[model samples]
Target chain A: MDDFKFPYFFNYPPYFTLQPVRDTREKQIQLWKELILKYCKHHKVFLINLEEEFPLFSNTSIDRRLTYESREVFLGALVSEGRAEWMDKGHKKCLILWRRIQDWADLILEFVHEYGLEEGVTTLEEIRTGDETQGTELAGIDRVVLVKALKLLEQRGKAAIFKGTSADDEGVKFSI
Target chain B: MRRRPGISGLQTAAATRDQYRSLGENVAKIRTDLMMEQLSIFRSQLEEFARKHKNDIRKSPAFRAQFHSMCAKIGVDPLASNKGFWAELLGIGDFYYELGVQIVNVCLSTRPHNGGLIDLEELRGLLSKQRRSSRDPITDDDCLRAISKLKALGSGFEVFSVGNRKLVRSVPTELNKDHNQILEIAQARGYVTSEEVQVSLMWHSGRVIDTLETLMKEGLAMVDDGHPDGIRRFWFPCVGSTSGAVEAGSELSS
Candidate 1:
């Protein structure tokens, strides 16, 4: 995370401003959208609270900060591109989807095939924090996103999600 | 001769006028033939020079410029057409045609960042970088000539002077004196303040805001509103410190 390098345009002062011109604004928004997704994926950050400080939104060297309206515009563009989603009606929080849900589902299937867990039953908690999932993309996945992906697999008859004896122990039974 | 004065004298006068007319016609034809012979000699000498120094003309921009001037003196346009004897003998027409294509590419690629107006020197720098594989350096003179050729497209590609600096405008944006003055002032720092423009140009706030806003609308200027001094700064990416900033940023990332 500390070794992450921003693009050259990060130092540009105008990048912090919402451009008034049509073509320039479009380019600026596209760059911002890409940088945001990259920064989020590198840090494993699934949530962006627009109310709080995000390092990518400002450059101290140039003394430039994105105004609140500008931040919404950039994030709005990301939402329209299906790369991000607003967490609230007020747009104070956003979910960064560096990897789309379908792609994540495909990764999970690959992981199951690699570990020979075709017909094994494993708890949701165990899948997230277990040694088998260590050092993989699924190790620190957000619970909400993981459940959605598991549901997609369930619809495809690849797995089943059932409640265990206790509510905390939800299990996933893989069919193949 | 005195006895036959009236009729014989009139006939003699008519005969003398006809003889003078024939002599004048002969002299005019001979002069024209000599002029044609001299022009042909000049053409042959030009062909000989071009054949002798074809490499110099192709490799060195200064040498090529000198050769162009020589052609101009003789009322010969080597770049006038791309398929005549000059094109076949010197390939100078294709040389300029290639340069024009590269120039347009650089302008189009950098237009998003520079808002379609770039400093002439900066344009040459970018042009050379793109043409590095060819090993032929481009000069300001060459750029001007190539750009002038672009005027036939009538697409608003032009070069103009502002505060002793030449700027190549790729768009049809009209910039008045106030806009030019602001661009000139921003060339020093890459950013300007309304206060600076007002004090330096001795204009009131209304005029300053109007001009700067027009630039903003055209995408030629970007506004920074987060300074601690609470003053809005308008930055011009087409002028001032662009290369230095790019180098510094690359150093940080690398």
Candidate 2:
């Protein structure tokens, strides 16, 4: 994460503020959207809690931080673009979809094909934290997001999700 | 002088006045014709000079500026017509025209950031960057000439000075003296608080806020309210680090 480089404008003081003019605000929002996505992806962060400290939203050197309104505005822009989603009605927490659900579903399918798991039945937890998924994008995956991706795969009739022997365990069978 | 008492004497006096008037008209016409001939000769010689050193004028900024000055002294606009000898021989007309178009593109591209106002030196840098494929290097003088030519299109393309910096304004919004003063104050640190402006400019808070708001509305200034002091800071990109270069060493090390 130390190798992650922020944009040059990240240090600019005014970048922390929400622009008032239409054109300027539009560009500002665009830059913020890009920075948010890149930052989350770099840190492997899937959630942004607006109430908590987000390092990208502040520059201590310049003594500037994005006000709550500006933070919400920028995150709201991402939500409207389908790059993120608000987790609560108050918009305090946001689920960052750095990679869209469709792409994640595709990656999951690719992973299954790479591991020759097309015909094998595996539990949902195994795909997420199993040894075969180590050092891969699927490691430490968010359950809800993974479920949504799996549901998308199921919709295409490529996979089946069903209960295992115990009520707590869920298994997925990939048809190909 | 004797007074004329009859119609014959009056007629002679009137004829003499008419003769003098005709002589003056003839002299004036001949003088104009001589000037036109001299001007035509100067034009041909200039054309010959341009044709001979066409590469120098195109390649060197200094030589190009000198050539433009000389043309100005003789009252010949080499960039007036795009189809004539000047354009055909030197392509100076097209040069500035191309520069003008590039200027507009640069301004438009940076407008989202700088709000249609840019430092002239930065503009030249961007223009040269955009013109990197061409052999010619443009000067500030060339930019001024091209921008002056752009004034004909009536889109508020003009250069003005604030403090020691020359700023090119592409927007039609006019900046009054107060706005200029605020900009000058902001130039030192890129951001100015209303209290500072009020103290330095000896202006009331109302005037300061009004002017700053105008700048904000015009996208010339952005406001920061996150400072520990809790005072609003107005940041002017046109006068600030918009043209700042990234320190390569620090970046590489980091």
Candidate 3:
């Protein structure tokens, strides 16, 4: 296995503990905050196991890992800002509210709207890996994210994306 | 912990009964003197702001009303927690004005942040430019005198009154040296992050008067020609103190 290394800020003591200084904490929050979103997005991580030792949660070379309380606080900050969501009442499984359900759904509608695919239907797998969605926000988009976004447009009576031939062949049919 | 000075040479409160009795007189004297000078400065600053931003001034009735309400409630116009709110409510202009004035209300005193003579000059400059001016009806001297009557109002006013957990005098002069050690013991971060200190002292009218009086007589911390920022701030301006720095965070919740 390759040796692991932490970033420069990973060695900063405040990275592990909660910062109380308003200004310092703010900057710290910005750095951690952006990192959280970026890391999750890159890994296509839909869920963050809060109780388990996630690699992103720690930097062993620097001997620094976020405390459970700090983890909760950072994640809580995300949840508050609508960037992430709690999957359960216990908050053990955070269905990373990344990209926002509305926004993800907007992506689908925009694809349909832009491509003029209003009456056409496309499979969910097709959306997850279609040439049309390539390099767009929709490419490699989480299945849950796709469903939620489509559901949002559905509520608006704009389109419908749902189950197709059996359980695996789900698709969308845009009413518009 | 004890606010009263406890130097060895200084007579103990009990031992110096007569001196202690005079202590009340001394506090009253200091308090009175500080108020007069502070008020003169306050009125002049207001006049200057009114003069300089005449058009924006006229347009910002809602923002002004919000400021007035905050000032009335706690002698400080409370700043909105978010900059977006300020932009939406007060317009994108005058962020410095919002921050400056609110800092006065919070850290400084009820006294306006400028001197009367300076304000008169600012007002004069505006008038020279041929602009309509506020008939505020009170000269700096008149306002100063009127506020001198409020010399007692600033009494018992304390920074600890501002709610940080409503922890009375919970603010320490310095961050705990152990903060670094605690961080080391706790998490993964190890880089040093410096804090940003913002400072603006607003003197109460009563305090202004007292400053003026004191400057006339004993000559207290009078470095910046009647501007309390110079004296109270010990020269560095606008959040320079190593102690007063607060941590920075994201500009947006998003």
Highest DockQ: give the candidate number. Answer: 1
Q: Please, what are the lDDT tens digits per residue for candidate 1 over residues A95-170?
A: 8888898888998898899889899888888778999889998888877678878999999999999999998788
Docking class of 3: incorrect
lDDT of 2 by residue, B174-228 (tens): 9999999998898899889999998999999899889999999898998877778
Indicate the residue-level lDDT of A77 in model 1.
Answer: 89
Better of 2 and 3 by TM-score: 2
Residue pairs with backbone atoms closer than 3 Å in model 2 (clashes): none
Kindly report which residue stretches of model 3 are placed more than 4 angstroms away from their true locations once superposed: A1-8, A19-31, B1-254
Candidate 1 C-alpha lDDT tens digits along B1-254:
45756887988999999999989989988998998998789778888888999989988988999988987887888888888888898888888888888889988987877789899998898888778886688899889888988888897899988787899999999999889999999988889999999999999999999999899888789877677788878889888545556665666656
Put the candidates in DockQ order, highest first.
1, 2, 3
How many clashing pairs per prediction, in order?
0, 0, 50
Residues A63-146 of candidate 3 have per-residue lDDT tens digits of: 556878777878888888888888789878777865789878777878888888889888888889989889888888877677
Q: Which ten residues in a row have the lowest lDDT in candidate 2 chain A?
A: A1-10
Best by TM-score: 1
- Write the candidate numbers in order of decreasing TM-score: 1, 2, 3
Worst 10 residues of 2 chain B by lDDT: B244-253
Q: What does candidate 3 score in Cα RMSD to the true structure?
A: 22.0
Model 2 DockQ (Cα-based): 0.41
CA error at residue B135 for candidate 2, angstroms = 4.0
Candidate models: Cα lDDT each: 0.85, 0.86, 0.48
